[model samples]
Target: MNIELHPRLAADCHRLGQVPEGLVLLQRNASLPWFLLVPATPREQLHELDPELRHAVVERWNRLAAWVARRFDCTRVNVAAIGNVVPQLHLHVVGRRHDDPLWPGVPWGQTLPARAYSEATLASFQTELASALDLTPAPR
Candidate 1:
């Protein structure tokens, strides 16, 4: 299936790899470990999906959440599917810490300047994540 990511998402993230149900993307911001899972389906809401597909997606979400929490040593992991901006069926898995820039606030609409990931850092992370999740790396 040819899954096209929303322009906004494509602009802001690094294509990591594909899982059984969807693509995984790493948000460009290095300050926080934010990941996105865009399921390959036309359905916009999680509840709209049939049981099997929904279960597959949720399983991926749980795996990504656990990985993010452990990798970032996060105080908390925020997972949501607020598609008001992009209207795509993408799940956000953000790692948060008490000392993080957004602290008590949500990452949405925040003006915190994105700390771009260096080439080595991004590549290393992509490799590690792909290995950890058994993902097929996105094409170069």
Candidate 2:
């Protein structure tokens, strides 16, 4: 199924690939290890999804959270599905460190210097993420 990402997500993230549950996207800001899973469904909430799909998405979310924590050596991993701004059913998995810029706080609505990933770095990250999650890379 072809899933169209919300405009805000499309604008702020780089398409990484597809997992069985949905499309995986890496946040544009390279400063933090943030990822999003956009499920291929019209449902606006996680609980509203079919049982099997919901389980698959949650399982993937857990895997992504663990992977992010390990890869980024984070002290904590934050997972949330706040759809107030964007109504699409997307799950956010973020790796956070105590020393991170937004330490002791969330990464929402905070204006920090944007650090974009270099093309080479982004390519490398995409490869590593695919391998780690066994995802099908998005077509070039």
Candidate 3:
């Protein structure tokens, strides 16, 4: 079944690529290194997915976490699925360093405005992430 992404999420994030688990990989348009794994299912939370799909999500999470740590030299990997604004089944994978703006604090609910990556920088990052994660472009 094909699922649709929410308009807000679509607008706020870039379609980095897609994972084998039928989930789309999105890069948040913020200064910090952030990504989102969104299952192409019409569910609001992880529990709503079938057992097999749930297992896939966990596997993807593990793979993504490891990749983020290695690629970014991040001190921490923050992954969560709290859909306060966009109530869709998606996971946020953030690469955080000790000296980051929100260091020792959560990135969520940070009052600071989003510092978007430059167009060229964003393109370069998308290339790097796609290569590292072995991600395919999401279907239009």
Candidate models: Cα lDDT each: 0.89, 0.88, 0.75
Error of model 1, residue 45, in angstroms: 0.6
Q: What is candidate 3's lDDT per residue for 20-65, written digit by digit as tens?
A: 6655555554667788888878778898899998998878877778
- Summarize candidate 2's per-residue lDDT along 12-123 as a digit string, tens digits: 9999889888899989998888899999999999999999999989998998998899889999998999999999999999899998899879987777668998878767
RMSD (CA, Å), candidate 1 to true, equals 1.2
Worst 10 residues of 3 by lDDT: 21-30
Which candidate number would show the highest lDDT if scored against the true structure?
1
Superposition TM-score, candidate 2 onto the true structure:
0.94
Give the TM-score of each candidate: 0.94, 0.94, 0.83
| Local distance difference test, candidate 3 | 0.75
Off by over 4 Å in 2: none
In candidate 1, what are the lDDT values of residues 42-140, reduced to their tens digit? 999999999999999999899999998998999999999999999989999999999999988998878776698887877777788787777887765
Structure candidate 2, residue pairs in collision: none
